[model samples]
Target: MSDEYQTSGEYLHLLSEPAWQALRTPVALALRDAASDATLLDVGAGTGLGTEVLAAAVPDGDVVAVEPSPALRAVLLSRLAARPDLRRRVTVVAGDALGVDLPARLGAVLAMNMIGHLDPDGRRAFLRRVAERLAPGAPLVLNLQPPTEPTPVPFSVFGTVPVGHHTYEGGGSAEPSGPDAVTWRMRYRVLDADGTALREDHADYRWHVIPADALLTELTEAGLTGEVGPLDVVRAVRRT
Candidate 1:
């Protein structure tokens, strides 16, 4: 998890709904072979949307949702509390993927939109651990976002939605910050019905970029084999 989400986390749903909807079926289909009792690990489980998807995918199993951002965890906990079914199946844990206390054997793992938080070395180390822990034949599913290299992204409005008498708008831009990373500058704004800006918040965070070849190499070194599925999502499994 990136500290950058502390301020902008509240507005995540406005931008992520479509992605979540599109991901639900693909993720579930990927995990269809999971054991009935295995515990699913959801790294970077922001606000519990992905957690819900995992819980649904494995009706008889449990899900551990790991999120390091307190602000985001607060929302996640609230969502769990409100949904009795999820409350019974999902446990919210507070820590990043590397620091969180994970189960000894995981049925599967989901790392959507959060892999950039880990630098190159960290990602390799994390992959090795996941390879060791994931059940044989189980999958580690993640998505590689754009700007696969350290590249500049021009600012643009990414999302807008109405909320009562106000409209919330979110946008971001990124610039090369290092050989393998970019710094994202994000802005969230609230506008009155008449379109006057009511309030605005800004946040910045570093995102490590991993090219497909590099990621595949790391996966191979970690003892896992990976393939790009629908929507370019990577499904990596430990080699037999």
Candidate 2:
């Protein structure tokens, strides 16, 4: 199985419940006004949890659940089979959001918590692609964890010397330490920009830390205007 699919399948159970709840509220806020028969795209639809929410909201609309993982695709197919009503409204595609052919003229694009998986360049490219696919004013809902606060230390060290006890510092440490040490955990996903996963084992090979402001800047550079609220999730819009 492909690494993307494997990673998705492995986390499917964990996402089945919590993800549904976490994403439902935001997705609804973005798409509630959509026509009942609107066509929606769920990019990086891991196990179709978000897709299910979209499907539920627009019972008569069509939802394209795009996922790059082979294993998760099969699982999603099985889940669809169990619900014929939703099955008819949803189409499962084995593809990546960064470079997939979206159906012509979509009403909205739902990119839930998937942007963090991409590097800065890749994220920009994906945003541009999404903007291209969406209709005017279509919303791109992005959910991501914000960077941990940086600790500040108050100390004045003028000369850098190996041996020197100058004076007592009056400020605290500037960086979080101990159990609060902030580090981006390595996460794996299916498919790279070249359309190949590093390995079939779905091993995580890199760690990433996303600064909220930097990410927003990258999105703006891509022609999408949005804001990351204090809650840390970004909801950007593609203007007509």
RMSD of each: 1.5, 14.3
lDDT of 1 by residue, 1-240 (tens): 347687898888766776778888887777666655678999999988888877777786888999988888888999899998889888888888788777989888989888899998899889988998889888898888879989999999987889899988999999999999999999999999999999999999899998888888899999999987787688899999
After TM-score superposition, the amount by which residue 113's alpha carbon in candidate 2 deviates from its true location, in angstroms, is: 2.6
Once fitted onto the true fold, the runs of candidate 1 whose alpha carbons sit more than 4 angstroms away are none
Model 2 is weakest, by summed lDDT over 10 consecutive residues, at 163-172
Which ranges in model 2 have alpha carbons more than 4 Å from their true place?
4-8, 35-38, 146-208, 229-231
TM-score versus the correct structure, for each prediction? 0.95, 0.69
Give candidate 2's error at residue 43 in angstroms. 1.0
* C-alpha lDDT values of all predictions: 0.86, 0.61
- Model 2 alpha-carbon miss at residue 212, Å: 2.5
TM-score of 2: 0.69
lDDT of 2 by residue, 1-240 (tens): 246435435544343454456657766776654544457888888767777776766678888899877777777788889998988789888888777787767767777756655665677788888777666666677666533343333433211111132211111113333322232322322334444443332223222346667767767877777776533556677644
